[model samples]
Structure formats: C-alpha cells, structure tokens
Target chain A: MSETDARPGYFGRFGGQFVPEALSGAITQLEEAWRDAEADPTFGLELDRLRSQYGGRPTPLYLAERLSEEAGLEVHLKREDLAHTGSHKLNNVVGQALLTTRMGKPRVIAETGAGQHGVATATAAALFGLECVVYMGAEDCRRQRLNVVRMQLLGAEVVPVESGTRTLKDAINEAMRDWVTNVDSTHYLIGSAMGPHPFPLIVRELQKVISVESKAQFAAQAGGLPDAVIACVGGGSNAIGSFAEFIDEPDVQLVGVEAAGEGIGTGRTAATITEGREAVLHGARSIALVDEDGQVKHAHSISAGLDYPGVGPEHAMLADSGRGRYVAATDREAIQGFRRLSELEGIIPALEPSHAIGWLLAHGRDELDAGATVILTVSGRGDKDVDEVVKVMTELGIAGDLGNEVVDADPREDPESDA
Target chain B: MSAVTDAFTRARDEGRAALVIYLPAGFPDMETSRACLEAAADSGADVLEVGFPFSDPMMDGPIIQAASQQALDHGYGVADDLDMCRSLTGEVDVPALVMTYVTIPDTRGFARFADEAAGAGLAGAILPDLPAGESDPWVREARRTGLDTVFLASSVSTDDRIDRIAEVSTGFVYAVGLMGVTGVKDVASDDSRTLVERIRSRTSTPVAVGLGVKTRQQAAEVASFADGVIVGSAVVQAASDGEPAGAAHRVADLVRELRAGVGSR
Candidate 1:
C-alpha cells in the first residue's frame, strides 16, 4: 500500500468513506489506532504470538502431485482450510479483535454470510473475552445450521436479520446500524475487505499474512515463485490476501474466481467485476449489481459466502490496472471442483474456493505453460458446506459429469472494461 | 434559500428553535404525501424533510426503515419522488429538503441531480450516507446550483470534526442528538447539547439536532439548546399507522405539537 492509499483512502476511485455520518468518527479513530498499531513493533509481536499460540499460524503449502499429474502441470494448495476456524477468515478477525481491545471497546459486532467469518469472529471474541454479536441473514442461518451452532457454542449472540433479501447484504446493513448506535462501546469487526475507508486497507494488511507466508513457503518448496496465484473472491478478502505479496511481480498472474450463480451476463450471478457497473454499495465505491435506476440487486450463488453483489475496491483497482484477471465459475462447476479435490486429493474444499479450483481445473492445464507452477489458496474447509453441497448435487441430479461446459475457452480478457 | 434561511431567522427572532419534520415521499400514494407535506407546513413546521425512499436504508432505525420500505413498495422511483419534491416545494411556503442515501444522487449524475433538484425548487439535501470527506463531488455540484448541502455532526465527533462540518454545512448543521439512527426517544441526551454548543462556538451556521427527537418534551429539551429540532420517525409512524383520511392530519397534529414544543422553549 502507498502512503496516499494508507491516508486519504482511494484505491483508484474505488475506496472511500461512504458510510453514514455517525460512523465517520469511529472510522477515523479506527484508522488512527490501526496506523499506530502498524507503527508499534510490540503490536506485531503480540499478534504473532497469538497467531502462533491460539490461532495456528503458518499453514502448509502442499504439492498436489496426483492432481498436477492429471493436469500435466505443477499445482500447489495453500491450506487455509486448516486454520482454526476451518477458514481463512480467522486472520482478519484476530487482528481486529486485538485492535478492539487496544481501542478499549468491550463489544464487537460483525456480519456473516456462510457463517465462516461469524464463527471466526465469535471464536476471537471468546478468546479475547470481548462481548460478541453477529448479524446473519435468516436464510443463511437456515443454510449453515452447524456453523450457527458453532457460533453459539463460542458464546456469541447471533442475530438473524429478516430484512431486505434476508442475505449477506441485509446482514451488513443491520450490522452498520448497530455500530452507528453503539459505537461508544463496540467495534464493528467487518468480515471482508469491502467496506469504507480504513477497512479495505485494514483487512488487506491483516490478511496479507496469507500471501506473505505462502510466498516464503512456495519459495522453499518449489525453489521459485509460482507463475500464477488464484483464490476465490467474495468480497475478495482471501483473494486479495493471496495476491498481495506477488502483486508487483509482473510475471505472476493473479486470478480471482467469482461465483456465477447461473451464468455470467444472465442477471443471476454474483460476478460483480464481470457483469456489474461502478456504484456505491455498503460503504465503498465499487462495481455492484444494480438495476437501471441505481438500486442494488440481490446476488445469487449456491454458496452463501459468494452471494454478495459487490467486490472489494482493491480488486476493482487490480482488474482495472490489468494486474489481476477475474473469472466466474457456475454452481455446477464449483460442485465439480469440490468433488474433484475431495476425490482426487482427499480434501473436501469449501464451496467458496471451489470456484477457484473449478477455474483451474477447467482452464489451468491448457492456459499455463507446460512447466509453469500454479498455487491455489484453499480458503476454507468444506465441513460447513457438506449438507448444502449435497442438497445442491442431489437437486441437480449430478452423480457424474452432466456434460456441463465449465469453461467457455473464451476468456473475458478484461473484466474492468467488459462491465 | 429564502424558505430555509428565513425559517431559521424567524425562529431565532421568535425566541425558539425551528421545527423540522420528515416524511417519506409517496408513502401510501403521491397525492397523500404531498398533502401531508402541505399540512405539515400549514401546521407550523418551520422546515420539511422529504425522504426519497430507498430499497436499503442502512442508517435508519426500524420505524423509519419500515416506513421507507412501505414507500418503496408503493413504487416510488427516484425521479418521480423529485417530482413530488417539486410539487410540494412549489405549493408549500417552507423549504423542503430531500433526505436520502447517497446512491440516489450517484445513480443520476451528481451535476444532473443537482440541476434537477434546483429545478424542482428544493432548498437543499441531506444525504446521511455522504459524509464530509467524500462529499466533494456532490457538494460542489449542489453548491454550483445554490443548493444548501447540509452535513451532520455526530455525537462522537471531535471538536475539529464538528468545526469542519459546521464550516461546510450550508442550510444548517445537522447535529445527531444521540448515537443512534432516526427513531423516537422519550428523552433527549446531554451529548446533543454539548455537540450543539461545540458547533455553535465554531461557526455561525444554524445547528439543528436530529436522531431520536420524538416527543414534545424531547423536542423542547433539544430546542432549549439547539437552533432547530428535527422530528422524523414519529412523523413517519403517523403516516404509516394512521388511516388514509387521517394520515396527513395525524402528521400535521404531531408537527403542531412539536412546533409548540419549540415555541414553549
């Protein structure tokens, strides 16, 4: 991040403070506290200690030899699924929880989609002894019942929001309202790198540890950098984290796989970068699915986590600058990815990152050079998604390949301009 | 400009705070909403806040959010609501400001939105989502067309932040009375008093306190220390709950009481 990006908060016209008036002071204070923490070495040392002791740092970078041999390429997986919360969401929440304590706020509020971030936040608040409240869509609560139970076990109050589309977007709106009302005693632990100023930066910095660790691990194992790094982009937290360290490496291709619920350009997708326009959603100016009159539309995806209508502003900047390439994977394709990883590699991948795996399987072998090395960040484990995935598979009647075209072979090439 | 600035001046001269009332556009129907705005003005509301209903009102409390949802369900589009604004501002004598989210103006180009607002005879706008830092584009366009761009001062704002808001805010500095959304409260907090005082010390702009100012007592309490007392959710509740014939009248009655509350102070 540049100095200008750190202070005034603009990622090439994508990031800004577009929240309600009541949140401005809290955001400013958070930015200052975050900056101070960044400057303090003690903060980093303590966070590292917690990361290692409590949250389990330095997850493995395993070479998928069988899968690579099948694809005729070198393939590696960053096992974020092995994180404490069974997802990579633990990275940002732990950082924010520490910041909440530093700010002297006793309560933390967050919004969740698939309940992975909610579970991570609840676990952090339990560890920190901070009062935790999570807002989740009522529909999501029904979909991810086990994770809901996990959150309650962590001693966090889960609020099922019934307003709007009864989904992640509504949960986020409800959480913001809670923050505006109780900002004096509470800190909003935003689950993604999508919201207003300081948040996109704060989350990126905290989650950047993923890319930092993976870079070192890959270098140690492969003796060189991978030609491509890919991850699924919901609000683009894990994708940004995976791409952050290798962003400036021009030779390294950064691919972000979005959820095309039905199909791209079908008006039934969460592929914001691929089929959306520039508009303000939540607290940042980013590409969002909006109607002609500027009202935001509800996003659809088989995976609750990727059912968000918008992407992080930095991802917008990356796509705009041609530093990152974004693609979409349909629900069938993601399921195929999930089955492939579980069957071939004995890893039940989360539905969210299955989009990435889907993209790689459908295109990686043909697109990448013969000797090219590829790294895919497995953002979460699939335990939370088992029932939902099974239900989807059963409904679609997919005991085997249904002759679905997972890849079009014709790449969007430029997501920024296409939208 | 005359309606808003003159209302403040008149209120100051009369030894009371101005009573600002909020009602969403096209709640139930366009005609009823227009009649409600006119009735509010006739019942002694010093200024009127015309809410352009949005699909997601993230900053609003349940009451206001419900009202907005009802209005949106009534099929109130952005441009059509502005037409309502034009009709009400043209008919009513008091200044009417549009209170909405940022996505409204952002959907229509800022300059075009400003021009249409000015053409509609609106006094100004208050976008709760468009804070001071990121408001340059909208503010510049609004100012270009001589529209008062009101900015809000939260209860948690620093003195420097209050000063910054007071300096840029035109029609009035909207000082949030509490740390909550637009809703009803039986009592007023001391934080609003402190915020208004801080704002008063920094700039000459009129300061209006909103957020949770519901009842007559609460209105009077805020009016004792502030230049304007804004009532939103209560008025919206009146429109939402009352019968068709009594809805506008109910809003007018509450505005009258709030007006009396300001006058009593």
Candidate 2:
C-alpha cells in the first residue's frame, strides 16, 4: 500500500501487507486513498498547514549547554518536549487520527501503559471528533493519576482493566479483547508496533514520520547520519521510529536503552532484549522475560514508561537477527543523569529517555566520536517525571526536598484538576 | 463407512459404550498433543474430537480456554492446525473427528476444509456454531468428500432442530449432557436421562450423550436411554492429572471405571 515499498516487504520481516480478512473491504479503500494522497503535492502542504495553523510545527532544537559543560560533550536536544501535550507521541497519534477519518473508522480504542498514549489517543479523538475509549491497567490508573485525569478531561472514557498482573500487559489484552468483540466499528490505535500480523508493520509506518523529520533536521545540522542513535524502549516505538531509517545504512549504529531497574542480573529489570529469553507473546515471535513455565514476568523500572517486561516484535527480531544492539541502564544511573542534566543543562529530560542519556553518559564522553553527532530521541518532556525525579533523588541522598523548587518536593497537582 | 454410520454400528454391535474424548491440538506442544490423541484412541475411545481453539470460544469454560491459550502460545497456526488430525493415523484405533467452533471451518474455507479434513484422515467435524439452515452446504460438501458432519444437539435446541440435526448428522447422535461447558458431571443424573429421551424420539441412529459424564454410574444411567455414552472433560482431566506416563494410566483407569459402570447400569 506504500509507494516506497516497490520491493516486496519492508526490510524483510519488518513490513507486510497482512490484514484480517474482515478488514479486507475497509483496508482496500484505505490503501487506495493513502497511496493517492501520498502522491499528491498538496498532501504535505495541507499537513504542514494543519500542523502550523491547527497544530504546531518545528518544536525546538536546544543545545544543553549546562549539561554539556559538566559532561564535557555538547548535547543538542530536539524539543518535541515543547510540542502540544508534551511528547513525541503526538507526532504519530495525530497522523494516525487523520488516517482514521480518511479510512472512515468513526471510533478508536487505545491501550495505555503509563497513560501517555492514553492522553495522546484522547487528544486525537477530541481533535477528530471521534468517540474514544482508553483502556488502562488498574495499577497504571493509580500510578499515573495525572494522565488519567488528562485523558478524562479530554473527553475519553477511561476503562480500568483488572486482569492479569493489573498493568499495561493486561490493559493491552483487555483492549485487544474489546477490539475483537467490537471489530465492526473500532480502529485499534495501537500505541506501539506489536501484536499480530500487520499491526507491528502498520504502527511502525505511522511512527516513522517522526524520524523522517529528525533525519532531515540532523542532516541539515551535521551533514550526515549521527554516529549512534539512542532511545528508550518500553514498547520500543520511539527507538524503532528513529533507528528504522538507518537500519540498512551500515555505518550508523542504533542503540536501544532499556531500564535495568536495580540491574538485569538481579532479575528485576525491564531489559526485554537483555534479560528476556526468546518466546512468543502478545501475538508474534518475540523475547519476553518469562519464567520457565511460560508465565510473563512482571517488569520493574523507575519510570512508569519503561516498566514493560517485553517489547514490540520488530525490536525482538532486530535484536535476534543482530541488526541492532540493546543495552541496559540502572535506575540509579538514570537518576544521576536526571539530576546531572537538570543541574547542568537547565532542561529536564523525560525519565524514560533519561535512561538512554544515562547510558551514553556513563560510557563516557570519550566513547563518542569527535564531530560525530548522536541523536537521542527526546521522546517526552520531563514535566510528568519531575515529581518522581525529586522523590528518587531525595531517596538517593543527593538532594533534600528543597522547598518548592525541588523536583520531588513539589506537591503533585490535585488529581481532579483539568490542566 | 460414514463416520456417523460407523459410530451407530459400533454402538449397536459392540454393545460397548462409546467414549468421546476431546483435546485441544497443540496443547503443551505438538508432540504432546499427538501423544494425547494417540493415547485417547488407544484407551478404547470410540470417537476423538480434537478441539480447534478460537480466541473467542463462546460455549467453552475456563479449562478448555486455558488449554487453548497454552497451545496458541507455542506457535500453532491455522493452516498447520487443521492438518493435525493426521496425528491419529497409526495409533487411531478409533474414528477421529475435529470439534471446532464453526468459525474455523468457515474462515479456513468450507469446501477446502471439508476436502482437506477428509484427506488428512479426519472422519468428521462437530461444529457447534453451524445451525442446520447454514449447515446444509457444509454437510453436503462433507458428504461428497466422504467426511462426516456431526452436529451438536444442545439441551436448549427446539424439538424441530433435533429432527433436522439428526437428519444431516451422519455420526451417532451427540446429545449434550450438561447445560454449560465441557467438564465432569454426574453421569446418570436426571438431566442426562431427560436429554437422552429427547434425542431418542428424533432419530433411529444410536444416540450418545457427551459433556460431563464423569463417573461410570452416570455413564450407566446415560447409557439407559442413549445407546452410547460420550465422555470428554473427564478424559482431559485424567490426561492432564500428572506426568505423561501417568496420563495414559489415569485415562485407562477412568475408562475402566466408565465401562464397568455402564455395563452394570
């Protein structure tokens, strides 16, 4: 259905034209319209217009001068953090919500991990005037009280999933069950590239647009691909989004940073690629941190966004096929990076992406090639994580809860507030 | 012989009750699944219905769904699944059938499934979803392919449906023993006797009651009205009770208990 895919499949096992037989009628229509719309010169023009007039564009690219002086390497930040709702997640959600209207699916259901995707989905649903239901784990609903309120304020009906481990996995399971039960009117806007058949392929395509923009931005800034690209992998969407373009380029290295909570060897880690053995989960062949008996293991992480035990199938295949390398960073190192970046750069990174920054920093600035640029996917802003960071830092004995300015010391906004 | 005709003849001639054992293919693993199928046949089961698991099995309870999920997690696909009926080939001393939701046969292609299932050493298919009105085409196709099309005669089925179901159903009539999912239940309970009587008036074909005929006493009571008794969930229970070696012995013991109970009854 894509114009660029004149050659069979996308990156071998990456993309497929697979769709459920029931979706044949609707997918055909969508494929035709998407193909034609993609070819039209005004497609980008209209998208740009909407992006600027309706939404915002060209967020910001700031150099972390304060942090660079401390680390001895200049770190340039792409301010997707400044964009509407505070994360790069909006880039794909807005695009897909547009496609849903084009495809005539009047409603959408999304499964959320830490409620970022839930908020993003609710935002899309509001913009497109479509009905939306966001399924959140009972645990996540309690942990991410703010995003739950954000989703509810955006007019989305938040459903609590009380099955399985009472987390994202269960919420995803329940959402998929809901979609299967209501496949007639539902377009499951998967937050990541995973699940059965075409889902992994489809979501990656939607999320690829972010990297496409970043690629152009980086090329304009530095004249070639970055030496190493890094991003956090919860469900592996943001990292996969950025690294996919350079997958076959040979020289460009892709590094996915997983949260090694405590550590990977300790058995409490969200490092799916590192700690997880091979197993089929969700719906595809992937690596999951499962016990010998085949039950999925609960993952641990400092950041709620990185708290999943397994990730999307493509990341698993990529790691298995040796196309990409995965590394784990301890939460302690991530906390240090959080304090380091905030203290040195005056810009606080999201706790999720901070793991990648932590890993890259821990390996030393000497590890980076001279004049070699490394693009760290600043997936989300640190606003949600500010309070969590303060709590962690205070616990780690680095800083006391200093009045109102302290990150963890700041009282979280009332759960009922609509901001 | 038509699987239906063969079932009736087996019940009429052997004077031995028919044991209908159900298993979800790919449970544990493909090897274990095949072993269980062979074990079911070797245990003197008259008919073995390999349950093809669906994501949504409306009629099934937790036990079967859990078994299905376990199987699906092991990389079982829809194409390779239908062909699993061939596992009964060498060890199948009894007629082998596929008991699936109507979705499988329909989604896989009706004619193709009928032909393939027959070619793959499959004797029959018992589809709970395909009602008589929609079953005509599949029944005809199955018959043409020399495959048996067995229909589940539910407790809730109207008297009119029992007549139509028996007309197209070539295998020995299957009278559901319980109102709910497949599991162990009192074999000779009043519900069993009443359901047996309901099927008795509809067809001359030997009637067998399946679903929850756990103990031999119930089997004996069920054997009173129905010519044969079909036991599924208890067999699965026996098969899964312990180690693989123990599974065969457990099943054999249960089968013995059932035969003795039915003989005395």
Candidate 3:
C-alpha cells in the first residue's frame, strides 16, 4: 500500500472512497492495479525512459539574477514550465496512462477546468494510442477555446458539460457519470491529487518528482537547501509535488498559495483552506467552498485552473497539522507577479503558479531570512494565459501600473482562526 | 408497524416482495409531494424512500437530477425535507425513508443531522455516497436514534464487501442492478440477481434490488428474486411529465402498477 492509502484511504480523516456504489467495484480495481504498478520494476524503467527520451527530464533549475537582485535574496526557479506539455500536469497524466495500459483498458476519460490537464492527458493518450474523451464545462470550453481545439487536434474528443455551476466541478460530475456508465472499458484519469482513495496517493507519488529533483539540484547548485519551497494550490497537485519531499524538514517551510480572487474574506475566492469547511466533494472529504445550504459554491478566480472550490485532502491535513502554510494572493497581486517574472526573468509563467510568485513578492519577501534562498516551482508556461491577463489589465485601465501594486496577507490564513 | 423491518416482514408474510417507490421530497411543490407520498401508500406501496435533493447529485441520472433541480428551485432544503417526512409519516402508516448524499449530513454535522432526521419521524436513512467503511459517525447516531441505516451492494462488489455492508445495514441491503447511475433501463440485468444471492449468503439482512428497475415488467422481474424492488427515476418521471397539480395522481397510478408488478411476482 502507498503511504497515504490507509485501508479506507484517508489522509487523517480527509480522503476516502466516497463515490456511489456503482463506482465502488471500478475504484477497487483501480486501487489494486495501482498497487501492482507500484511493485513492478519495469513500470519504473519504462517511465524513466519515457521521461528522458520523450518528456525532457531534469528541466533546469535556473538562478534568477534579476528577480534575486530585486528582492535582495537568491531566488531559484524549478523550470517545470519547460516540460513537454508546458505544465507539471504531465507528470501525473503520464504515470496514470501507464497504469491504464497495465490494466489493459483501451479507453481513458478525464475532466479539466483550465484545459492544461486536458491537453496533457490527451497528449499521453495519443502517445499510448488510446481512445480519450475529455469533459469540460461549457463556460470553460468558451473561455479556453484554444486549448479545446488543441485537445481535439491531439485526437481526443472534447465534450462540453452543461450541468451544475458549468465549471470544473460540473465537468468532474459528468466525467464521473461517464466513468460509471463505461467502467468496464474506461479509466478516469483524474487530473489533480484529489478524488477518492488511490487517486490522491497515486497522484502525489507521480508528482513527487518535482521536489525530489529540486532537492538534489538545490544541494548541487546552492550547496545547501533553500529556506522555503513554494507552489500554487488549485486542487494542490503541484503544491503537493513541491512539498512532499521537504515535509520532514521542519526548518524549510512549505508554503501553498491559493487564489484569493477578489480576496479571501470577500466571499468570492478559491482560498479553500483559508475560507472553507470540511465537506465531501468529487468523492473525497476535504475543505470545500460551500454555501450555508451545503451547496458547493462557484469559486471565482482569474486563473481557471485555480478556480476549484475544493482542494486535495493531504493539503488539508498538512495545513491542519501546521506542517504546511496555506495563504492566498489576490488577482491584482497575481497579475503584478505575472508581469514581474516576464519582464525581470523573461519567463511568462502560468497564472496558477503566478499566485505563488505573487505571495513571494509581497508578504513572503519579509518572512524569509536576509540572504536566504527561496525555491519556487514555476508549474507551467503562460501561453494559455497571456490573452486573459492582457484583457484583465486593459479592462481595469491599469495597463502599465500592473506591477506597481503590492499585496498583503489576509488574516484568515492565520493559525489562530484554524482552531 | 411504520418501521422498515415491519414493512419487509409484512411483504414476506404476504408472499410478495415489498414495493418501494423513490420520490424527491417537495418536488414541484410541498403540498403535491405530501399528497404523492399519501397516494403511494394508498396505492399499496409498502415503503416510501423520499429523496432529499442535493445540488450535486453524483449518483443520479438525468430524470432524477432534473427532479432534484426542480425541488431545489422550489426552495427545498434539509429542514423542508425533514418537515415533509414528518408530515408524510404523521399522515401515512408506512416507513418513510430519506435518501440523500453524505454532504448534507457532513455539512450539517453527522450526529446532529441523523438525530434531527430521526426526530422528524423518518424510519431510516439511505446515503448513496457513503460506503460502510466511512459510516462510523452517521451509523452510530442513526442506531442511537432507532433509525435504520441502509447500505448498498453492487455487481462489482466482492463477497467481503457485501459482508461488510450487510453487517452494519439495519433496514436492508440495496443491491444495484447494474454498474450505472439511477436511471431507467429496458430490463433488470442478471447481475442484480447474482448480487442479491451473494448478499443473501453473506447476511440475513433483507436485500432490495434498485437502479434501472423502471417499468412494471422490470420491477416484476426484480421482485421475483429480491425481497424488495425500488423504482426511482420511473416514478419521478411520471410525476414530472405533467402539470404540478396532477403529479400525485400520476404517482398514484404508477404506484398501483408497480404494486401489481410486485404482487404478480
């Protein structure tokens, strides 16, 4: 069993197999297949070969001279943006696709919000020559039309879902429905490190490479570990990946930044850990944005990827246990960080990771020790988000003043409120 | 006499399977929904499994989902559903069961939710999303309040899982007919019969076959082998296919047909 797959699969009372009984048999089969894949040595050898030969392994850890000078501290960037699919989503998809093949299932289905995971899962499906169908909300299909077309071009069918809220949560519901109907021949390639049982454990193990590589690279480049490792939290795939290896090192703080949308306390944000309650969502028990009536609310974020109302269960446990700090960055501050990285380092980062950069530039700057090093996981490139950022800036009439604003920490992330 | 066990025992004594009709509470409107529940009992429905509409119904298909959305649009919440159950149980001498998602109880506090549901005169609760393994809190509270907790078995479930679900289940074990959501199908599959047999071997708990048992003939087919047959989407469809005032009439007619279907078995 994986470290997190504790019998009924809970991360300290967070994750469990909370799906319908129609899906119980399928989920159990998936859990068994995952265990088998973990034991087989060839699975590792094949994945390694694919990573090095096809996925461009060991994406460089670059020292940001300009950004470091601006902050007066040495800042290093783990360049996951340079991976084959331009995001860290490929790490989980590639691993899951391998498991699908081992299970001998000829088809895969997935649900995506920002379309990054859709494109990545489609890419792996194409490589494996499997039939793939992706469910995206009608609104997200309209917003991320380009990525929708990209998925179609990659030989995957893109189905637009028009149920509940018409967003990521709806897309997931549709995908789960489809999986239930076609459980015999299909595998649901869940994008994030969330969902029932083996998915959270499976996704975290697949994504742990980010922190593992960053640890070794930091030891080689800076001759010591960075004082802090930061990543953005949507469903918390990249954040969990970036923090899993450093969880035991108490001195090296693990920071997970969430999208504040307008602001955390403003009642319109995706800051799940900061402003959410324990609820069952998408077959997992985690912190979720819900109304007083127990209806899952629509989370607003400029970044579609970070617009999810619920997060991975492990992130909930980590935050609850005080091992990981969960914070938020407003849209305006994220745009400022987006502009700073592009102008200072010539790297246009994805909006999801820009939340992490936003936190580092604003409140995180004062928290780090003087001259201490900080490592940030730039989870994806900004090709999918460039137009959205420009539109927001132009609409606000703050074209050139985007980088002039600084954000402060919302007190909801304070540990005192946690009790 | 209003408990689920009494209903099942009566049906067994009569040499017929129990006819359980699943309807969403406050569908269309509260008055008509209460009328429908009474009509169901009057039309020989042995048990009432009233669905509490959830915004995100993961286990429901198009028909039930649409009915749930309609109920939600009519301003139905946990309190309204419980009040509907109280009113229905007070008026009718049948076991009124509440079918809901785990989020309702999880959000409202599991023990408190179960206790309040019991206080509302509900004989039992059916949480489609909660498996036997993760049901400690709700099960404890439900047992404490004398409310039966029903668990589900599916075609994909192993013998061990069936045994696990049957042990904690008090009302009955729901045996899913197929590996799909709650919807209408042309016929009840043989998998459900085999699953019911599997559950029977594991425990002495009554087994109710549900999911895709839509038409009268399908209900009859399922009733031949199981202790109870549940028809959800079919009755909901009949109620929603006409004007709101006429929903109870349509439900009463469908309940008569389903009751006949069970009696024929």
Best-performing candidate as measured by DockQ: 1
Instruction: Write the residue-wise lDDT of candidate 3 on A30-104 in tens digits.
Output: 889988888999999888888878899778889999988877678899999999989998999999999999899
Candidate number with the higher lDDT (2 or 3): 3
Score chain B of candidate 2 by TM-score: 0.90
State every prediction's TM-score relative to the real structure.
0.94, 0.62, 0.94
lDDT of 1 by residue, A1-419 (tens): 63144337888878888887778779988999999999999899988998888878888999999878766778899999998999999999999999999999999999999999999999999999999999999999999999999999999999999998899999999999899888889999999999998899999999999999999999999988899998999999999999999998888999999999988877889999998888888999888887755777889999999999989999988887788999899998899899899989999999999998887788777777885798999999999888888778878887444333454645576677676
Interface residue Cα RMSD of candidate 2 after superposition: 11.9
Q: List where candidate 2 sits over 4 angstroms from the true fold.
A: A1-46, A292-294, A364-367, A390-399, A402-419, B1-265
Task: DockQ each candidate and list the results.
Answer: 0.74, 0.05, 0.71
- What 10-residue stretch in candidate 1 chain B is worst by lDDT? B180-189
Q: In candidate 3 chain B, where is summed lDDT lowest over 10 consecutive residues?
A: B180-189
| Candidate 1 CAPRI classification by DockQ | medium
Candidate 3, pairs of clashing residues: none
Q: How many backbone clashes does candidate 2 have?
A: 8
TM-score of 3: 0.94
Off by over 4 Å in 3: A1-8, A400-419, B184-187
lDDT, candidate 3, B1-265, per-residue tens: 2379889989999999999989998887888888888899999999999888888898888898888888888877889888888888888988888899888888988778878888888998999899997888889988888889999888887777777899889988888887778883544468888888989998877899988887788888999999999988898888889898898899999999999899888
